[model samples]
Target: MSKKKNKSKTLKNEPSSLHLFDQIYNNPHFHDIVFLIGKEETKAYGHKLVLSMNSPIWKGMFYTQEWMETKGREECLVRIPDLDPKVFLGFLEWIYTRKAKISHTTIYGIYKLAHKYCMPDLKQYCTVRFRKILNGRNCLRHAERSVIEGISKWHKISLKYLMQNSKKFMNNGKCFAGLREETVRTILEMKNLNCPEILLFRALKYWAENIQNDLIKKNKTEIYERILINPDQKKITARKLVKKYLHLIRLDLMDFKNYNELIKSGYYDHRILLKEGFNVVKKFDLKAKTKSRSGPQLSDSKILLIGWCRSGETHVNDLINSLKSGGIENVTHMDPTVSIPSLKAMQRYDAIVVRSSNVNSFYKGGNLGSNLAKYVDEGNGVIVIAINTLINNPEKQIRGKFQNQNYIPLKIAERERSEQCSLGKVFKPNHPIMRDVKTFKCKEYSHFIKTNDLNGGHIIASWDNGYPLITEKRRNDNSGIVVCLNFHPISTRITNDCGKAWLQETDGNLIFSNTLSYLIKDKLSKLAQKNPKKKIFYKK
Candidate 1:
């Protein structure tokens, strides 16, 4: 009983760990070190033992061989250049008390210091705190500043986080000022950026103008005299600031109104516009073609055709002709079986069409389909044509190929067999793909593949037996579009042939053209809506 009572008293008398830290922090009477930080030579106090224990940098400074011979037992003075006194104080407080006050203004500085001092826990704490403070209003400023001042590793982390989470903030025009040229180019290159290309141009213009104004303010008399001599020189000088970054912007993505406004605003040089071969009259003519019932014509869009085509086969050629007839201007055919292009090369095209004779071989070759799925996620368009061989063996061919990919819209059924082609009914008659399309006709022995709806994909057209024949899925925010046609839309058949390819003049051709048009139009329309007005340019 007496021992138990003694133990209870001992427990009551002992202080908690936090209380001990607070006591150590409050008792500054025996501080043995002083850090002079920043230009003002501000002093920060801490115990050498505590500092050395918490920071490897401090340990090296106090206990290394040279230090022990010079100033080991004496009071030590260290200078930290360019570091804010308050930030250093926060660091010291954390070292002594296991707690520190962190805010937006001080977070980056503290993170830098913590990294330099090899304090992983403190660095992690600052990183978490900084992420929490990121929002639509402040993300741009934080990102710009971090890139400008952070180390390479920290810069990468900050940029990756901003790209994934702070897209809304990047849309604000004010965020563009004072950015590095490489940073601006990187942002423009992102496929999934929510901002329009035109707005990005305006932002680049604003930044260039601001940089010129700052230069003029700093060299007031010289610049003023030069400008007075040649009034056009000011415009020339401002354009020079952003010239290197200009070509990275995709001028083709801009609509007619926005493109015209950019030209008239005098933000870019006439020589550069001419070099890009941008003719105002041609642009206007192209805009006029967007009003067709097939939806907007993709005259400026680039389409990539991937797969093999035999010399005598007219299916691929016929489809290409149909697309060209519907006003698509640029189409490149590539045989992925020969050599799969890199993702960067693939991104040059606006839409991708994949046709494979052996679906299993295509799936196993260099992760092409998965990479294409990533491309689709970045606000592009994809059309996948599953051949009869793939459809007839859904388990071994279709599901096996696409088991790990989410880009395919349809889920394959277990049972796979060939069935006589029946007349297909328009599942959604009002859908853009079915705008002028009525009954879909196909050749006999054209295998009908069964599919389940996946990724919110709805049946755009179905067979008379109610099996889905066509599926369409649009991603969130309309970032991308995917359409899967179960049967070949383009075929080569003689007039008397029964089980040949689709007829060139059949409804299948029209539907295929309309689907391509709709996907391209949707992508362009969203780009136009990214920033609808010029007012955002004046925000800063």
Candidate 2:
């Protein structure tokens, strides 16, 4: 009979299995289980079979003897205490139709519900969604939750975001005060926080004041300030409120001026401030997570002086004394003829100052020029004083090793002259390296290593013959600073047998000291750029 000529037709009039389950979700007539949820006790309907198939917790609860005994009773209801109705409703929807409605407002609640119900897939989905919606405004809250839930990944990501926007978060009055005490302590404990310590202290003060005021209100007191008496007759003060987290701040690393201001503010106890002051003075903090977040100060920076340090000569000693007078106290003298430090050892210094009366010693130990070039590339500053060498001399070996340094910012040629009246005229007097440097006195017959090609460096000062005296060039990648002083090292102030031909005045000292200061400032500025704050040049 040709199989009764059966016709194949689409079932367009009926809903699919998933769509039918979704349509009947939360309908009391079709669901066997009724969930009374939240403080409002809102009702959510769920099918036992559908819930049991999705979650083992639901499966075990539904198959219990107590639930089986009341299977046919209409009064049987599952009470989901302390859960939002919307969150429970979303959970039921996922069980029935494999879809969830997730938003920022309900995500945290939904995640908790999913975790409580032993739903790994839903928990993973929520974790991915958390990453997408995280920002500066919500990072602290999310980080707090992550720590509680032991979710290490989101905790790290959230804290990293907090560190990036720490200046804004700490400076904003409302946001800073609204943070929970534990959350505030967690942020304070971070090692890489680059915000100023004074701002952190102020935020802590605001947070403590708010907490103290809240305690006062709870005790039915009229106190507006931080000091109040609680119901148990215990005194509440700002210091007591912030005592647990106070020591997390690196008080030793803060500027002494700011530390004094913190003491004057009177938010913390005098004993705490005194102890921190002791730590600062002793250069010792056993609890400090870092030495300095903003990079080394001029006093803390190490300078490598590679030059002649003869017992009777003051050429290198003069430079060292001037640098120390300008707050650069850590200068190490390394005679190039004796030994040249490894590149790894050279990285320990913030800058290197190279001055030599004889260029032959540069190639004595190792490749000093190449190591210096690599040092500058690794973000350290270099100052080259080529005043003693003769660039036009027919000595190829001496001149070749000196001229091969790519880190030198200028091209040296045969454009030099010996003149006793070759005074330095400041072109960029406002420049940091030229600060307080008007004119430097030239010693008797000082050799001027004049250069016409500056190689894109700015002339801070010049010879009377229009040659570049002191030129500054920053690396193309902004990694380091190079300052070239095109005058004889004999022009430096010294007191020795050859003091007649050497410099012996304050102008030379002021210029050299200012040049070292400028290089350190530039180096710290570069280090600050690696952090999250806006690029700001370190002001003298």
Candidate 3:
């Protein structure tokens, strides 16, 4: 036998505490047991943990320092990948508190820790603050680098995004081509930049280049006037000429790093107000789906969305993606434009959601055919994308002060309504979506919807102009509730107009979370009823 054999035997008897601790700490509640047992005697008194102790994935989501060491570095918050230095400080607070609060600060080192160390709760805090400080037109160079750090972290988390947006990075004009292809490939493979901010930087890098081609040739006669007269007049070195002008280009001052302190230390609350939807909507639910799965009675089902991947699609894709990711059982989709119309093809889903305004039907008149509206109205569960928008305008407005679970419309129009942010606007304080929305400071901007017959509907979200942007109607004249929204926010008149997309980030967060919750609650309750929990009451 060898000394290695002797050591291996000792290891088997002693057991690796790191491995055992990792197995146990994953269940946060287990700490309570140790606490109950008293700390000094924990090593011997605690029961041995084995692979059998595997907890559900949810329990595993919580990470500890030991775990962080095992996972490589970096944490990612999907909210804002550009964890600019401003976002970094907030991440620090989140790490300390385990609660994500919005902050505006630029501290790259802290964000780097959050991204590397499995610190999402902290990362989210940083993202909120970053968003606050950088909301307006006054973006500076110091803040950009920090945001770039965040973007890089998110790249570590989502290759889907990197793979999807690769072309955009190549096209954004970064002197990427100037850099050696091998270097560019390594950076891209490493996911080194926030995709969007990376796009912006690449653009800036191009503009900063000194190279140029004379489009319409200027007279060289004047060019010779100074150089030809030369040293007799005054001599200047090439480096001197370059350095002097380098001081002149104010754009060179654009560094994301420097402005980050303002994000952390400045008036961020006011910045959040600069976004049109800041106050109008709310942040993400982050509210986890309860494992209990209690409530209504139903069967295992799936939802198929039609017209989702059409020529124009917006929030629909995001909503569907979220439901699937959240583990909300029983959901699927087939964009009407993507699949050929056939009753058999459409019949696969227990529920069908039409996500766009354009209507194409295989269910219209044939045997396999069920009338489009009638088919949905009679289904077990159906979500109709702005049904009214199918026959009307593609854009819709979002406004009405939410109040007592209802919106008292300040204004209503058949077409898209401008942002109706009015002082009179009121919203339901207790509404789940509005819970985070109350603190949202708002900036005014408009989103369009394809809708009609605004009367006799419950307004869920409204515009500051005091008009209803999202409404639901349930009445005797019509049975199924009408979820009135837009055909596509991106396709509407606001593509680049007022940054309806940027400002509405919160709205997208709110509306999608709410709608998905509604569908999940409705679907899950019904299913839970069929699978009742066993009773286990006892008496002495």
Candidate 4:
């Protein structure tokens, strides 16, 4: 009995049997077939029996007379020039071990190989993982690739997600470039898409610019010389690239200010605008029927937040979530230490929020101030928060001086008063921004803005100490709205610089929510009047 038990235990713990799974994978000792994958022709080893048992395509390639040309060779050489070697190895690993490591980065590549080789199990595995990881950033790319690969189910799900979240994705300008024209047209034709006409137009503009940029990148010298010869060619090519899908966009649905900005955008020819009656002259005409989308209210908008909170000083995540819960669909934060989009790219958002500090590692010398000023001048909204800069930090003050100019509604004073306080007398109580915004308090008092140097701005509210609490400005030409909330807003409970835990105010969230909504409404309103007709589609 002891001898028999020892034999069973030895069989269970045998090294050769235990490591067979690993040895069969990529081991040349038993590999009878070699795969040369990708453009580089990288080699991957596999056994004919294992691959043929798993994939009918591999079975036919190895045994059928159709590939008899490869018979009698020491090792069958299969040229898989389209697949990555690592992906091919992953598929082989699955055949041996019945489990393969998959990730967001490798699922699509692996799926393509699985589909091409007719391995249903691996393809199903890829599909499950792909669906789990599908998101706004990669949905369009995935949908496009799935369509190309004839993956009807995957294409439908991805495209459906994209259409449902069109407004959020479009406003953030994620992965719109290089999509098939047909796919773009299909998205534009989606009646259920909730995006505003202005936002959709901006996304299309981004797509066209990216396409033009790629073309220029591929043939830089040639395109540059051509552009030098005919400077208008750049805009001309941009307009032509998107010409096919123009009609799908409801241009008449856009507000007058945005329509005018589009005309000045130079992405479309003047004649096209005139011919299509997209000109401002036809904006208010009764014959021009303006129809809003069926999704969220036209009040649906996006915001770009450009600022960073130092650790322990502020809670940026809490602020972002608060804004999101407050009806803003998208709030994209651009870390100043990273990259800031150009003014043209900034056009995608209805409003931009600049936190106190405005220094960037990429754009040194504080260029965002000039760009944001130009952004506001181009008929978009801006909210300059937390006064301008810390008074003690001379370096931050110098770097953030530009934020106070151009679009900022007010200039920050030289001093910052850091003391706990509450909202004082309401100067503009009936104002949209002040709606439901009662009982505001801050652990730290904000810097005062120079009232005399408001540049035609108005003080909306004041602190208990009579400092400017909330200020707003309207451009002389009616370009866009600018609101300055004059406090170091800390939305989440955290230990302050003084090492004391400060309780967060939910009112802070309401204040920002109200401010963002007010800013967006100010920009997206129709010209001179609101459309009397409200188009509602009842669900079936």
Candidate 5:
């Protein structure tokens, strides 16, 4: 009688066969989902099953998604392939429910996927695994693309982390071993590869494979020529090379995806994806015979920052990113010591800005940084920051000077390791530079000395320290305004959520863009300057 009662109770409590409970144990996509072998995959991999991809799923598969959702985030089974079934399930349970766990193996797979999908958080998690197994040659290939793709995703990738794995990759990995010279040259010229030691390996790779034949041909040709034209064979960085060759893939470039359609549109070459990229500066005639009919032109009106050590891209991101977010992204950063091609890039800017830090780098007679000083006197109403050198190291001043000035030999420690913020923290709301920064936030980085040195300099803002935080000095009877000061800037605001919170969130670049707008409009009255203020929005 007890057995008969229990049987009746079970029949009453059982779910119908048509329900999701039956489907979960049967569906191929659901039941045999990829094995996530590792604590990371077991824990975070559950997100995949629950992912709300709106793309159509079959009506029959509806129950699969439903059951997975009902099971909850912490109670999923993630079995590793080729493992004892019971053991793997038990390990997955520990990881998902925090009961027991397994070693990490699915990390490399997930990391590559995370990178592809622009998952910043997940990519960071993969970084830990990459760093942990830096010595393991087994994972370098997967790891290399992970870092590269992540760098392509973020505004500026910190290479310090990847440097640790360099030696391990050099030991015996095919990814490092079989790297083509064109590929090596591409990375080097793009400024993507990091570290001197790592750089040496890539250089060694390029020389051993790609450059060897080219070097012999070049030597023979040079010997045949009677005249010798002095040349400076510039060393291209991997990051820069990638930028020159690959279409701007900081994110993905949108060329037509359907290959056959693109070819059918009277185009010849379909192999080269992302059609709008070339080494413009490297090309003899800045134009390329792209398969796409669109011709490349003198583009990117880059703002050439002429400043002392105070602005090392510390805060310019806010303004730069803001305009970028609203279908109006213009500007790329170039520092004097870090990237000098920027000086030549100056031809691109519609109007120029001379910041306080810039003044010291160009002015201050006898200082190495002061060599560029003559331009500051031009004052095309160029917005100059209010200051001299951020620090008083004579050696630093010497290193700042150009090659002809005999300052190149003296290598002073740059502020690469130091954080310098101007003690002054106030701003005058009415200044021209302030015209664009609606955030009204002051910069907090170390600024060089602000001199009332110019007789006509206007004090637009000041800090509690009584130093001028923002000032603009008139030059040549207002032909230009040399902005000089130590006030906080909008760049700090852009990076933090103070102003716009999008455009990959770097230091205030959009504010810098707005400032450029103001300067350009101020210089050439005929030029149309868009309404003041950083374009506050998110781009991508």
Candidate 6:
């Protein structure tokens, strides 16, 4: 029994047979297969059993009885002339150890080799690693090759992720010049792209210019002279190159000012613009509409309201109903704690109103302020209502907490003073926001924002003490219009449900509705100015 136990223990202590096979890999005496790769005739050695087991292609090539008999052990060699020597060696390492380092230079080659050899595991590993390494800085260098290989190899999903994440880096004009056509098309189709369409259009133009420049560089001196003599032909060629991408540009979404500039620059072909239904006259009409309050009426505008009014249900509900009756059809309310819509989502609405007591935490957590600023800069409108909640008491300066204060037209005071039952006077009686309404009374709690004269901000309404209670900054060349109300229209008593006893005031509600109408009307008027008029002929 003791002798039997000793024999059993010895058998259990022995290394597994697969471990022995691992030791034989790349061992010259054990290597039964040789692969000669690339033009350099680089050599890689491996065991037939190990290679065959790991790869289906290798199994079919080396394990068939006829192949084994036809190519004797001593003279047998498998040549992979398409793969790079370094890449084949990297594959060999992975086959032996189930691991290999893949760099940008070697990744393409290794991926191809892995696919050719039917090593699905290695192929998948390399594909995942390739995506991990791709980023904004390095993407421009690798985009062309990566797209070609990734598409051909059926790694489309990974490639898409890489392209989407790296697009922000393509903001550089030169970087865009190097992108493949496929890469540009794919990026433009992405619905969730963080970049504005105008930037993409500029990049596309740069790419077209580069193509023309490249054509000139490759031609004979006489051909170059001909191009210079017939510059229109060169322009035609560049236009043709960019034609495939023009439709991808969201011209409708571009601000009238920027679109006008693009048309006036004449960098692109007029014929192409006409084909896309983008006539310069139409844009001019749209611009004209902006200044004309009597331009064609627009469809009902959508407005987003954020933050709860400290005032009771009557005040909040009354304000909402007033906006609806004033022609603002759709109103969506959002909780401050919820994630704000992205800039792309914000584009759907004509105007946005943000009101929050804990506005700082809401802005920081949601990362919304910059996106909002961009939205306004793109020619949309924003209304910010500041309420001095208890949260603002400990943190005295409410203005400093605003992450996007720079975008706000009014200069907010660092400190806020509390006043009871103050009356606000109309500073700008003729202003569009106050077109229908005149003077309004403020509740017990009201805050003030100082104005910067250099910013071209207008104080449309002021407190009895001379502090600006409401300010309007019209959209200029650089940014969209912003209206800041220092005091809440709905009283805190209404928010606390105590003001329900008092009937909803018509004056305050009318002012809020007028403000909404002014923002929408202003935006539409600008749009109409750029719109081209269609001529109708009368049949006599």
Q: Please identify model 6 stretches exceeding 4 Å from their true place.
A: 1-25, 138-147, 150-155, 162-167, 219-236, 268-540
Candidate 4's C-alpha runs over 4 A off are 1-300, 312-314, 358-366, 388-406, 444-453, 496-503, 526-540
Best by TM-score: 1
**What's the true lDDT of residue 245 in model 2?**
69
Give the best candidate by lDDT: 2
lDDT of 5: 0.37
TM-score of each: 0.46, 0.44, 0.32, 0.43, 0.30, 0.43
Model 4 TM-score (2 dp): 0.43
Quality of model 6 by C-alpha lDDT: 0.61
**How high is the CA lDDT of each candidate model?**
0.65, 0.68, 0.37, 0.66, 0.37, 0.61
**Tens digits of per-residue lDDT for model 6, 371-469:** 776777777778876444212333322232233355565543443545542536776787767765644555434444433331456777776777666
- Model 1 residue runs over 4 Å out of place are 1-19, 38-40, 64-69, 72-76, 79-82, 136-138, 157-172, 220-236, 241-244, 267-540
Candidate 2, which ten residues in sequence have the lowest lDDT sum? 393-402
Which lDDT tens digits does candidate 4 get at residues 170-266?
A: 7775356667655666677665566677677777777767657866577654544323224444354567755656677676576666666666876
* Residue range 17-102, candidate 5, lDDT tens digits: 43333233222343423455544443223223332221123123434767558645443554444334434443223223322222
* Model 2 TM-score relative to the real fold: 0.44
Q: What TM-score does prediction 5 earn?
A: 0.30
User: How far is 478's C-alpha from truth in model 5 (Å)?
Assistant: 6.4
Residue 509 in candidate 5 has what lDDT?
A: 44
Which 10-residue window of candidate 4 scores lowest in summed lDDT?
A: 494-503
